[model samples]
Target: MPVVPVGRSADNAVTTSPQRQRPTIAIVGAGIAGLAAAWELVAGPDSQGGDGPEVVVLESSDRIGGKLRSTEFAGRNVDLAADAFLAQRPEATGLCDELDLTGELVPVGASGASIWARGRLRPMPEGLSLGVPTRSWWPFYRSGILSTGESLRVATDLVVPHRGTVGVTGDRSVGDIVGERLGRPIVERLVDPLIGGIHAGGVDDLSAAATFPQLIAASRQSGSLLRQLGRARVPAPRSAAPPPLFWSLRGTTASLAVALAGALARRGVAVHTGVSVDAVERAGPAGANGATHPSWTIALGGSGPPPTGAVVMADGTSSLRVDGVVLAAPAREAAVLLGPLAPVAAGLLSAVEYASVALVTLAFDPGAIRSPLHGTGFLVPRISTFDGRPALITGCTYLGRKWPHLARPGDELLRVSVGRFGDSRPAGLDDDELTAAVFAELTRLLDIVGTPVETMVTRWNGAFPQYRVGHLDRVARIEQSVAELGGVAVAGATYRGVGIPACIGSGQTAARLVLESLSAGADPAGRSPGRVDPTR
Candidate 1:
């Protein structure tokens, strides 16, 4: 491996360990990634007596753990927002155990889904298969979502010949793959809404490699997704998981914030809320690890000049001089800041797109809905567009049915996520207008005649990131650019993934890079043993 030259800090110590009595590691965002990095660095299997990385978590928001908001409504707990991270992801679940939060972990309910495709609440295709179909007509036959013809079309995937090679380096759009394998209707009726809801992109715009990589891999390995029925290794179930683990959480996801906060606290990480970061830059000694920009300097006051180190900008900030750096913010945020500094990386980051969304949580009386929300909830297909934007009820969860610990029988919770990219409702619409719009749509779709008992509208201006086709190429270019820049590492939804697990993976990966860089700088090994390839 070749060594990259970098600026060095003459003052600070090169190494950090628990035995040093005081070792500090700074994290900019308090979201799962930031908190997870803090948890692992301070409390993971690596926590030993060699001067542990003392952690300092800074947040621009008033609270820590961005987006995972579980709150109270009408005296019962609710997760109006992000529910649970997929248990199969393992990163988030693993942290839960490391933090002793194993008991708080809960499974999602699986009463099944109600589709609104052919215009009715039919059961979601019997064997979900996500975007991939298994039984010829499972989704169409089993789901009220599609027609018999549509079901037949979807089954055709069994014979859909392999087009391109798929692997970590391969890429394909969900729309392209689905439509090619399954006809247009199945793509529209089943694939559009289901895959669209999760990705927040028009199927044509989302990447199969990034958004539904597993399904893509399955399609590759099985050679026939339709035939791999009795066998697909489904997402694993949790200790107290609901519905065998394939959907969102029942209650509000706010507790994820609470749990993470508790974990960071126990590990002695200083949580700073309501503080904003301005920029990040490289200035660390080229630790034997070529990736470590050992000296990092950051400007904090938003206007005044500031601090530096292996500075990790986990916030929604821009470039600053720092030795080691990690960016755990969203894709757009990363692009905005890194654009001027690392144009190639920034452009690649920019290539990875995002979609806007609005989530409306509605609380209804148990008797109002046509059927009990048995499982997690229903999903709205991207095809069911409202005013050019996909408008999906995404099904309502019978909060009372899923979790025994939450909600009374009479009190029911329904989270109706509304909108996808550029939904043109009047910008001036009052809260009442938004609320009315959500309820009206739900009532018309689910046959619920009554009004919601409670309501909330969360507008994530740029909440969901869209990973498009050719995304892999762009990210690879990004990695190359950053590698040349030296000593700086980037993580978060922008490069690798968007979910909680993806973000956790990205952030920890950044930390690991920094650690690895430190290791490389000191050790003659030059890089991780596996990474030391002479092929290049």
Candidate 2:
């Protein structure tokens, strides 16, 4: 492990002479997480020692914004990846507020979504908490997805006796607990679709404690999950209006990323795109030169050219020495960077698997769909099949209906998401093949009257991380181990969460750890792990 110089003050942290040296911190990766980290270092309050340190962001790719990207299409802007984020979570909305984007933030439309299952599109049952209906029978039975007998079996959950404290231990899969209490039918039809949609992973493999804390907390009570959820449900006040449950910029999400980069530029934080840091290693005591601050040697030029400014400082070499480093790449990349330095943490990170999903956006004439489009979109149950085979397309969202701004009169824009965990159909299909498949599915489900005017197919390979059972435990261990390494911190969707908000929070928190260690000139292992609030 690399050891930072611990004897020098800010006045003489890293210079050869008596002149003072401002600590130089390098953020590897310019994705949302990496950008968020730079935001923290340059914007956070001055440390007890003095002012903030000099910083630089290095990205392997020419483009920024890892997943939050949007572009002009169909004469309007639309997100290619995630369209909206969970507004209920403060991490993302808080960033929007800080960035002064409140006015542009818009909630999803009033239209709700339907479920495509049992060979039909049925209205989703009301009172579903991530697929667990509040009651046993009413909504589930009326949904028509479940038969009368199956509906009665769900009702048994309300009267069923205790199963010796399910989901009370370390951690369990959502499918296990939900199936044990509510029945497998509900797990297959309801839980898998909603929760699985969010993670793109199987409910049977997802960690209940890590993914649905609220459900697990409520389940610990005396009643069933349904009764507990019913008791916990708080009705909104009729007099007061509720805000939007999801939010995004008026334009593309990429605008936010661009705005953040511009903000970093204004702060004089060196921004370097198309530069990849191949390796991070300890400068060794010989390179530390008796200074108390830790020293790092960053190797560049594997994925892209090194930054121009950094190239000179590299003195014609492929490596440059820095005071500290923040690793904000995806889990797979992070694992590769950490393998030589922190083998254990790298191994833990490599163990986390990822899934690939493809999005097909199509524009059609408003009159093309003869039937009135109902709700925002429809999610196909995993059990759904087309011509006696598993359905390739997972879900569909009517963009124009959901957000009126994206379409003009007589225009209908639809975004279709295809693929799931352990499914290779999405990645295997080309643009034409995927578009035809999704279009065929949409026609089969909605009976469209005409062909699409324009269409786009975007494939995201290994973008979503699967939070398998014991995810929290793995994250805790990963963090603890990294803390011991002292001068480095890791942040991204791979660690705590996978949403925009979670990634931002993780970046900010990682920056804090790096800044703190640099300021104190001490080993991080001796101090508390980190300041990030895991609950958020």
Candidate 3:
């Protein structure tokens, strides 16, 4: 593929248009999803055709990785955001295999996290599926996380079973289904801490269809929810141990993004950081041969390096005219960029909400802890209180214990997470105040003796997008509106799943969508024939 020369212009209009051999696609945002999209454009089976599309990725941040980041802590590299990805989801592991990093994939060293209930840390019950007891009731009853009355309420599911509708209904909140079946106590104690913690929001408003479809599917059965979930479980061989629940790279899960960015760069894809996309608008009318014309114009800002093939306007701004575009940015940013082209998509994207969270990593002398660190970590339900107030810390991870590679003889590393949807207490406190408060809670929960040897706080504002009831419908509308713009698509956690694997899948899917649109010579104002499947 020949490089499209950069041309300077005194006006906002594109000044150069030379015949090109391959289609050029610009990907906005350099996060995992965006990087994944660029990879697909340059190396996927479709890209194997002749010369692949000229791909360029732009990010507003100074670095390539978005929320997937790691830093040196206690003489080892530790992840500040997500530490691992679900092994059941193949995207992350498949990406690792493709990058030849499969050998570096490491399963979590520990298991069986506990929950703080009734003023004590109790081991989470076994045979639980996303916090709902799927197997026998004996294990859950013996865990002692619930009171006698609460246990009896849970037993009602088996004795006097609550029969839900015979078929799958419209979207319902996770909290409503679980509370109705098992009891409110179960939702408050078990379900909220596990499922709710994943999205950093309460389950009461979270959409079951979007978040936990397994639960929703099981709920539709006539009999017990527990029995239905148990039947749905795919059994493993009795002779072998179960597979690992989660996996991370040897260095850190963050390395997945780093490795992906490197791989994209190696494929001749221009990956630029600290560059923000200002707007995405239609260029002039299609050429006599519609397939050859660049249909979209992307306005660029920020002090980041100019795109290698961008047209430099006299106003000092950079712009790229591309055959297609993938708006792989965050929901808010995508909304702003799509406002001029797709007002419906912009409005729906703007309405999506996000949750902020802080992870405080602290290292303490091994001897300072009174009790032995067990399992990976423990979760604090929103209802759990500390010192007569609602708990400030949502959960805590024994980083060194969970990832043995990070363990040191001198100190034990702990990561404490705070804040969630509708929780503003953490936002009010500065780093020092937040760290101190988290430590105080840790001191009581873990029976720590003194202060930490080192402390670091990482804040991820607007990190987790809430999947409220009817979220999937909203995403469908957003996708449909954008599809009408022809050769453009949006991808990210805000539209689909938020896990690393989900984000990767979302990006690849978006790539395929735009590629189809461009190859078919889609009309900019006409409906796209191949709209993305929202259920994916």
Candidate 4:
């Protein structure tokens, strides 16, 4: 392996002169968050009208996008993971507007979805706030998702007055609060399937403060929990139609990452894939004068030979020296890198757990369907059973119906999700067996007749970071410890949020911290950086 040293080209030729030397910022991952961080470093307000910092992105995998990926299936680009992002968040849309991709954005065509309840597929109750019905009686009674007894139990929230203000006092699990107010039936049938499905973990231990802070505020009110949540909702203009709940790109959601990577290349940002970072160590002694920040040396390893002009060490390892770094890798990888520098941050990161999931895309003939496929698809509650045992399938999406671009005249495309935190059933089955099992469940759920024409299975292991109780406090401590290192910052799903928008915001914030340190020569106060305005 050859080492590509700083200030040198791939052919061992000097690229930048000593007179034109500039600060170099290294981003440790090439995922969406890392890419967003690189963007903020070069394209943000601080970089405009001047020579920007030299930015380089390193990724371990053969590809750039982490869990955001797509493939050519059934002659169209189909997402194997998340297919859309929440439209209410501005980070994703704001970044797309800057990338000249605003015209390619597409809104969801379908609305509403079903939940498997009482051994049948029933429409989700209207006026739901994250699976907790805001309107107490009519919607639940009409949908019939809950039994007559369960429906009456929910109605009690309207008349019953809870004693304590536990929600506002401190951190608590989502299930603990919802079940206490709305009854256990709602938690098992609605809350777990929706909220739990989002994190790929049971909400019984999921953090309410981190995931849904609004729930806490609503719970503090004295009146009905249902009415309180209804009042808490942000109302749209009375005359205007409500905006789309989610958005996706024309080709695939993964195009956002690809487009961002190309934009980075055009701006002279070097993005290297298939390279693993072995360690991050202090480069040398601190600078002279009033400088308190220390530079860093990053060790690199890969299967291929090192790029020419790299500083190959005596041990045959390549290394690069950068003034600052954005550690945007996952929690496990971040923990390993921070162990030597910030042990507290490393230990906190190590404690953050992740969940694995698998997406199975199947194409069926239009004639095989027995019931009209309503809405986008349906979700299976954790308590649901099939074949006299717990169901392995969690949810399913009608790809062709939801995204008209992927529709075919004779083909009905469906994407089924399997596996969640603490569920090992999907892991035990091979591709063929898993596909068959999912198909069998679908046959009963959708009343299908024949086999699928084509099938594909994609697995994402440890993709979702579980936000357990007290997650936000833990994140605060982690950031404080990393800030003490002066020029180092952490970003990605593990800290703030897991959605595309949240991850993008996380990356941009980290970039701002690095920029501040680089400009001031050091961050002595170890203060938390403010969020970069998405509009800016």
Candidate 5:
């Protein structure tokens, strides 16, 4: 097969035609990563008189958005999944704008949040990002979140020498770093639960450097993490937005997948589902005759279009020989697929651990609980979330108050969080038992009580990745290994962050990498795709 030339022309008009001849890109996953990659390739400029770059996205799942799963429950819609992205998380916000969805964004209202700690419900001390108290003094002396002595210790976070010792694995676990720097009180009570809970990683294994880059930057940049946080600013208020609260599509995060999928379809991407790729072996370049096109023997064993270029794993399964392959699966999953392509990367991918988590959504007659369900719920400190025990409730979002569609007069919507992986799941406990447990805990701490009108429980094993200290080295190693694989790259929460924004950014980054590789006349592996573009 003769090497198909790139620089194909872009009509750039509203019209899209499958004129063929342009470089073909195969995207394996339809998830955000894959979709983003495919969109990037399709949107690239090609001078050829023919069509622009072509993209094919293959997904194994019937639907898309791995782990960002959301399903309908009760007469109301429960996030049964992720509800919002931090306003500060740039990646997700940027993607929304790029997708023209930024206007739809809603910030969690300013009603404020609380933390379930030290046997009670206390307002999240102002100046706290996650559990790291930005304002050490107020919380230290006045807040109920920590004891006076504990607060002083936390406030002394100013003086804790940076003791982030790298482990033999050559990385620092969040456990050692935070413990050394902030001490046990902060780590056990707030840091562990708030920050640690995000990735479901315990302090001992979470990577402070990789997982919480900003936090580390805070400490390094300002000499004190507390000081850096003390300056943290909330996003400006907006009125045109719906409810001005952290928001999600009335459906589920799945709506994001649907929107992207639809957008891809409109953009002329060939989307194939139920396709399973066994293995990806590099095929030789197309001969000068052009009869033998650079292709992938679709391992479907069943049937499908014989594969080709810009292989994007939108759904996370790694496969294809194209301009590039962007992996968008969990780190462990990436580890399994890229093992042969990049061993160290595979090792690092495997090494970057994940924690299991469970989310329980309990519905109640608003009047049932002691206090009116307000603002966002509370976070159970790691001590409470850990202890191999789930807090009576990690936090409850007043769903109705959050999004207008979620709740209304006479009806109420409340989502109760339960277990974090490594913490005991709410299994074995019946609905009544779980509800009672939550109530007991809530009552014990918040001084509220009432019976649930209805309840829902969910458990996610390895919900998010815990980038322990030295995670950067691990990721760098993995990147080098992937580079050697020729046309493959990895992206997603497993590498950078766990928020919807970060993941979306990962997808966009992977897309840009693919674009850059293309313009450089490099194949998926950075070599010429088919013919040596001597010009380069």
Candidate 6:
């Protein structure tokens, strides 16, 4: 494999000739998904044309990393959004291995978290799978999140006759399934807070298959969620405990993106930031390589098409012809690009909804809060209300306590999350208002006094995509429709799953789909006989 020179040639056309030209692919949106796709294309075995096809990553934003950004505060590196990834998920950890970042992987400091429930902070129940009590009845009964009666009702699930196959094959809301088996109290008090925190939406509207596939799989295996969990549980050995469930790069999440960007540069992959793709379409019958597949023209912010032997350029906006495209932007962004070419898949992408959230990170005097900030911060139950008003703060992460590397003696860093589905108040509030509201609540919740030494409020609008019931089916339809287009594919938080690992997996999958079509000499304007399944 050899390095490929990047950028447009002297005549403003792609440098390679049709006879020996390598296929070029464009990746839109330089988030984790797009970067991961590029990594797979350049670093994976399938990459052709010396090391790989000429790759170009276009980012709408001035920088990359999207939600995986980190900033320095309180004399330590702090993640503005997600701090870590599930170590059990092979994609994220696997990508780290490929990047030679395994040495920097550090496990989370402390494991368990607490919940503010029933007018008090209570420890979360132990041995629970996503808040479904599994090992014993005592944990749930004592956790105080659920009433004693509710705990007993949940325990009865072990002997309760298996319900009809609602979740056996089809889909159901997480709230519906959990409520039916364990009662409303467990669903509202326990499951809703934990799962809802992840999606920033109500569990009643979240897809059981997409959100809690383990529970669905368990339901099929044992007919009872509780029984299946119990049977699956492996007690910790007395002599040694298990490893941490989550891990992060020691340099912070943003460092991973920085490293990846550096790797792309070294591989001669052209990455252009602050470039918005207005639209994408099939250019003609053949690509720069004179192949049926990979012939696509991207409309830039400027107007008009590129002249023959010259890439379109107007007011710093230029259109580039490519062999294949990976639409790794947000669901809505992707829909806008795909609407003109593949309306069915565009509609499905449009149907995928999103939830916005705000993270208010404050650096407060260590002496201001007297209470022992135990564990990782705490989650606010969806049902929780303050002053007869809904709880404004969704959850809080005690940065210093949760990760020892960020610990400092004089002050503490607290990241408070606000907003969720059906809750538009936080979104409407100004940053100052949001900070004040969150600060007041934090003071009350943590028995803190005085003001913060510093504050930073980061709002992620439409950052989380809501995976409603039948989400998997919807994704399949979207993929099928995209596949029919031959050279175009989509990947992001909108499909399959929304976590870091899931997004990475989707990107890698999308890259393969597009490359396979290109390599097979498939048609770009119509359905291809050699289109590959993204799931495989």
TM per model? 0.81, 0.90, 0.94, 0.93, 0.79, 0.91
Tens-digit lDDT string for candidate 6 (167-251): 4588889999888877898888889889988999999999989998877677666466886877776655565657777888886
Model 3, span 1-536: residue lDDT tens: 21333643322223224445677788999888999898888877667755778788989889987888999988899998989999998888888988999999988999889999988899997789889888888889899999989998988888785667866669999999999899999999999988899999999999998998888888988888889888887675576667888998999999989988888878888788878899876774345244433367788899987776677666778777777889888899999998767778888889989999999999998798887677999999999887789998999999988998888899988999999999988889999999999988887788888889999999999989999999999999999888767778899899889999999999999999888887666475542223322332
The clash number for model 5 is: 49
Q: Write the per-residue lDDT of candidate 2 for residues 359-419, one digit (tens) a residue.
A: 9999898789875677778888788888887887788888876776675896888899988
Candidate 5 global TM-score: 0.79
C-alpha positional error of residue 41 in candidate 3 after TM-score superposition, expressed in Å: 1.3
Q: Judged by TM-score relative to the true structure, which candidate is superior, 1 or 2? A: 2
Q: Please give the range of 10 consecutive residues that has the lowest summed lDDT in model 6.
A: 1-10
Q: Can you list the residue pairs that collide in candidate 4?
A: 2-306, 3-310, 4-310, 5-309, 5-310
Ordering by lDDT: 3, 4, 6, 2, 1, 5
Residue-wise C-alpha lDDT for candidate 4, range 397-484, written one tens digit per residue: 9999899889999899999999999998888999999999999999889889889999999999997999999999999999988876
Error of 1 at 248 (Å): 8.5
Indicate the residue-level lDDT of 500 in model 4. 94
TM-score for candidate 4, please give it: 0.93
Over 4 Å off in model 4, which ranges? 1-21, 163-168, 285-292, 304-310, 523-536
Off by over 4 Å in 3: 1-18, 285-289, 292-294, 527-536
> In model 2, which runs have C-alpha deviations exceeding 4 angstroms?
1-18, 45-50, 135-137, 163-167, 231-240, 285-287, 302-305, 308-317, 524-536
Q: Write the per-residue lDDT of candidate 1 for residues 116-207, one digit (tens) a residue.
A: 66565566655556645554454346655556777676666666664545454567787776677666876776676777777666777778
Identify the runs in model 6 with alpha carbons over 4 angstroms from their true place: 1-17, 45-51, 163-168, 220-223, 232-241, 286-290, 302-310, 314-316, 524-536
Tens digits of per-residue lDDT, candidate 5, 1-536, equal 22321122222110112233455455666666667666666654452234665566766666676666676666755565677766555655555565677666655544666666676667766556666766446644576677877777776767865443233234456566567666787777777767766776666777766766555555455356566656653545665653442446545545666677777777777666666455544444333124123233222321343233323333433334343456666777677766555567777788765665556565665566666444566666655643455454555666766666666565566666666545564665766677677666655554445656667767666677767667777777777666554445677777777777767777777766654554444334433233332221
* Per-candidate count of clashing residue pairs (backbone under 3 Å): 57, 6, 0, 5, 49, 1
Q: Who is ahead in TM-score, 5 or 6?
A: 6
Error of 1 at 91 (Å): 1.0
